[model samples]
Every structure is written in structure tokens, then in C-alpha cells.
Target: MTDSPLHVTVKLNAKLQPEHRHELFEDPLDALLESAELGQLTGGGTALTDEGEVDYGDIEIALTDPASLPGVIELLEQLGAPKGSLIQRAGEPDQPFGVTEGLALYLNGTDLPDEVYEQCDSNYVFEQIVERIEGVGEICSWWQGPTETALYLYGVSFETLRERIADLVATYPLCQGARVVKIA
Candidate 1:
């Protein structure tokens, strides 16, 4: 099945002049598109000839996976976006998925030993995984519900994470039923 597209909207800071809006958001938007392997804006644009109607630094894109957001956020941070620059889902009321500090691996179904949890927590496991692959940011483990335990990681390349965790679960039977989740 095709993944549902997510609308990524970058709204400019008011301090930006209308004339500079396109230049400011253009590269970041392109970076988001390139990193996500996406094309085209979903909706909205500034008036070309009417400066009075022009809005500052707004760019929108439709991304294929919610997981792609972190890369875009990282790129925007690198681009030196203004303090009030906003990234959000186009039509949603809640904050955008990009706001999530990290990705989470939700492990449920198996009731592993407490010692296993202590030893294979996100930080320890992330350290092990990153030795084989280069990944940045923090990760740690914790319980989310009565039955659900999670391994949360800050920076992620989603596919890399899935493969790494699949390997981890292969060696550690305790995580056999883990499902990668994004916690925003």
C-alpha cells in the first residue's frame, strides 16, 4: 500500500520582509524535497506583483512518510531559520510531526526480564547499533503503558533504524515484536 502523504508547511517569521520570503524558504524547502525525495508544493503561494498581499517565507510540501520530517528539521536548523519559523502539518490542529524530538521503537507483547530491560535500554542498544552505523542523537528506554515498553532515539534515518533494530531483535528475543513508532 502507498504511504499517505504528509503536508509540510514552513511559515516564516514576521521579522522577514516580504521581498526576502522566497529566498529564505526556497533552499530549505528544496532540501526538504530532496531529502524526502518528494516533488511540488501542496498549497499556498505569495502574490507575485502585489507586495501588499505578499506573505513572508511560506513554503509547503507533501512528504510521503511522517518519518521524513526529522531530516527536514535538521536541514532547516542548519539553514539558520529565524526564531519564529514554524514547521507544521498543513491542516492539522496539533503540532507537526516534525516537532517530535526523536523516533521511538515500541516493543510490546513480550514480557522480558527486568534485567533484560536494564541492559538493553535505548541508550545501550543505540550505542551498540551506532558502532556499526553512524547515527547521532540520544536514545533511551522506558515503559509507556502497562503493556508497552519503548526505545526512544533522538536523531534517526528511519530505514536505518528499522534495519538495525531488526538485527537487534534477531539477537535478543525480548524485542522480537517491536514496531518502530514516531512519538510527537
Candidate 2:
């Protein structure tokens, strides 16, 4: 099966007061889309969710890769938006690692395959790892932290997954470093 597109939810807490919420921007949706990198804003009429979760507005976009998530979040943050955003598999996002800060991989069990907890500081690089080793065991659950992300996985062996992780670390940019830890 082909890989799923990234479905992202970006929430914005506008810097405006309630009375002036309508004046947050001339065209808030347009203002938001200007900063996007990989995906485009899908609809035309009213893309705003008006879900009341955000003080301002919320928009959803579809991206080709989860790796582009960091860029999307960065743009939203710059505009005082995306207080927090989540990405999921376009198809079955509600599944494990389906939603997360920047990106996540929720896995099963402890004592990973080879005592190897492959990780990198850059979400972009981590996205590469996800792309390379996806569709193994169950979906990966990830927690994107300030400095790094911890990815929990299952069903895959260390020798196999590690080789690909190592190869990605060696070949890609933004993933200058990686660590494999044994969680006892």
C-alpha cells in the first residue's frame, strides 16, 4: 500500500481580544496559508473550524510527508498561531502515533528489539527514519521534545531497523547525530 499523506491540525490562539476577534486579520485563512511549505489549504469558502478551542482560528492541511511537520509548526508559531499542532496518517490517523506535538510514534511493549531506541534531535531527520522504516510491526508512537524525540516501536527486529536507522543517520542532513539506548 502507498504511504498516507500527513493530516495536520493547527490551532491558533490569536493575540486579539474577543471584541476584536473578527479583526484578527483581513483574511485569516489566507494569512495562515502564506506560511505553509509542503501542503496547501484545501477548501475555499470557510476553512476555519471555529471549534472554540483556539481564541482565533484553526485550519487543517494535508501534507505528503510527516517530515515537513516541523516547518509547518515553525511557520504557525511565527505568526502567533499553532500553539500546538498534530499530524496523523491521512487514512487512519487515530491509530497509534496518529497525533503528536511535532511528530510521534506510539509502539507496544518495552525492551525494544535490540536495546536500540533510535532517535535524533531534528524532527525532519526523524521523519526520514519514519519514512524509511514505516509499515513495520504496528505504527510507531513518537513524542517530540525540545531537544529530541523518543519513538516507541514494536514487531521489528533490531538488526533490521537499526541498519536502516544507521544508514539514515549517515546519509542525511539535519540528522547529524543519533543514539540507540536500551531501556531496562
- Taking all chains together, each candidate's TM-score versus the true structure is 0.39, 0.30
* Residue 101 displacement (Å), model 2: 19
The number of clashing residue pairs in each candidate reads 0, 6
lDDT per residue as tens, model 1, 27-143: 556755776576556654543223242223466777776776676666665544434456766566534223223346666534767776666655555466556444543342233
**Model 2 lowest lDDT segment of ten:** 95-104
Which stretches of candidate 2 lie above 4 Å from their native place?
Answer: 1-3, 15-37, 43-56, 82-184
Give a tens-digit lDDT track for model 2, residues 58-94.
3466665678666665554443332232333346443
Please tell me which predicted candidate would have the highest TM-score against the true structure. Answer: 1
lDDT of 1 at 40: 50
